[model samples]
Target: MADIVDTAVSAGSFTSLVAAVQAAGLVDTLKGPGPFTVFAPTDDAFAKLPAGTVEALFNDIPQLTKILTYHVVSGKVMAADVVKLTSAKTVEGSEVKIDASNGVKINDATVTAADVVADNGVIHVIDSVLLPA
Candidate 1:
């Protein structure tokens, strides 16, 4: 199996996300071992941001890294595991609330697709970019 980066690239829906990850210098980290659970936002999700939001973040590496890392948790949390949790700590050092009452939400983003397996971790596609509070 391919790594998270490769899997996302192959999926073709994460073009913006992959670009942001590259810009944030997180390609290596996400491809590394130890099982990360990434709530990956799609290109459409990035588009949901304000007009200048994506452009602004692209130039701010530190803040960009924070936002990208906020989407990641340090475990291979699948859909079943995620549904059982109320919250999970992110790699960015903040906790994201998980609400399974409707479908499944991480912070304010809805989980659109789940259990996308990767060699090093798992990816759950989300519908919005999760901004840290």
Candidate 2:
């Protein structure tokens, strides 16, 4: 399997996310060693954002990084492990509410796909992009 960066690129469903990651200069970081748990939002999820939101974020690195990091947890938390928790702290130092009672939801997004293997970690595809509160 490819690393986080390459795996995301290959998925083809995370264009907006990929662009944001690149803009935040986090591609290399996410591609590095160890394990990471990424709640990856699909391009469709980004499209749900109000017009100009994505564009506006790219121009603001701090905001973009904050939003992107909200989608990531520090360790390789697979679906099974995540379901056992009521919440998980993200790398951004914020807690994401996890509701596994009805499928799996992280914040306001629902997990559409889970346990996607990557060289550096795992990917759980979400239907909505998570924003920091």
Reference-based TM-score of each model: 0.98, 0.98
Deviating ranges (above 4 Å) for candidate 1: none
For residues 1-133, could you state the per-residue lDDT of candidate 1 as single tens digits?
9999999999999999999999999999988885999999999999999999999999999999999999999989999999999999999999999999999999889999999999999999999999999
Candidate 2 local lDDT, 1-133, one digit each (tens): 7998899998888888999999999998999995899999999999999999999999999999999998999889999899999999999998999999999989879999999999899999999989998
Q: Candidate 1, which ten residues in sequence have the lowest lDDT sum?
A: 25-34
Worst 10 residues of 2 by lDDT: 27-36
Q: How many angstroms is residue 38 displaced in model 1 relative to the true structure, after the best TM-score fit?
A: 0.3
> What is the RMSD, in Å, between candidate 2 and the native fold over all Cα?
0.6
CA error at residue 99 for candidate 1, angstroms = 0.4
Tell me which residue pairs clash in candidate 1.
none
Angstrom error of the Cα, residue 104, model 2: value is 0.5
